[model samples]
Target: MPDENTDSLRPPPPTGWRRRIARAPLLLFRAGLGPLLGRRLLLLHHTGRVSGQDRRVVLEVVAYEPDSPAWTVASGFGAGADWYRNLGADPKTVLQFGNRHHAVTARFLSAEDGAAIMEEYGARRPRTARRLCAFMGLPSDGSASALRRAGRAIPFVRLESDPPRRLESDPPRPFV
Candidate 1:
């Protein structure tokens, strides 16, 4: 188990070649090859808080709900991560999963909710959850309580798709 006093063992964001490798997914996303990554990952398009310039990053989908059309992701690098902070500044953004894009609004999940989600994820994907916990510098005992504890520490964001708008040129459908 990780020391309770130490919130995270995660290192600072990557630099140099590590940064390049970390950003490789963005290239694939830009090349319209995001489908190759399937639904497990998504390309987030957000605006820089300071620069007002657009920024993009590929993040893993921690949990997905088809009915809500929502995708939850965690900031492995914690709250100080650029992307996480950027979303706080402006929750409205675009999310690209596979080849489809949707206008989404970020909803920050409470620590309790995050903990539950983490426990469920661990149950569903034990190995991946363990690896993720290790990567985040959290406990990887493959136990529900441990996973929940880790989850409570990590920040989670749920991206919900905005309802699609009808075009002015499109005819309205008649009620069945």
Candidate 2:
């Protein structure tokens, strides 16, 4: 793994209008514009760990299980990200991919798993992997060791939805 003293992979989170601009896709997803991104991105709905308020963030999907309602995402901002922390506090959340929304349980992947996933993702999307690494301030060489280092520095989460078990007292939301 790279030394901890190394600069963060990506720039610090944006502020003011920049933050709002970054979040525009969240609004678009809620407004039903999700399909435009297809399986590349997912809208994660989670609760604020401190304020106890609902929050959502759009994350790039690292891998999507075709036969299952499971998706993997990476925190390009590393483990200290608010969304990542919130998910740690409460693993149960919602993930919206395109028009399909599913309630999922979050699981933090092990470093080895993250490394493997990153390698596969880099292999499948070499350009995206290089760009992502560059944005994160990591070397964009796309080498196995370089990818493993990037994976170790960033945090990866897998979201898996449970089999439906609707409650009689609760209403069900339509899922496209």
Q: On a 0 to 100 scale, what is the lDDT of residue 113 in model 2?
A: 89
lDDT of 2 by residue, 1-176 (tens): 23345435368988999999888888889889999987888999999998999998999899989777799999877777899889999999888889988989999998788888988888999899989889888885989889887777667899998788879998878899
Pairing residues by index, what is the TM-score of model 2?
A: 0.86
Per residue, candidate 1 scores C-alpha lDDT tens digits across 75-146 of 888887788889999999998999989899999999899899999989999999999888777876999999
Minimum summed lDDT over a 10-residue window in model 2 is located at 1-10
Model 1 residue runs over 4 Å out of place are 1-8, 167-171
Q: Highest lDDT, which number?
A: 1
Q: Return the top candidate by TM-score.
A: 1
lDDT of each: 0.88, 0.85
Q: Return model 1's CA RMSD, one decimal.
A: 3.0
RMSD of each: 3.0, 4.5
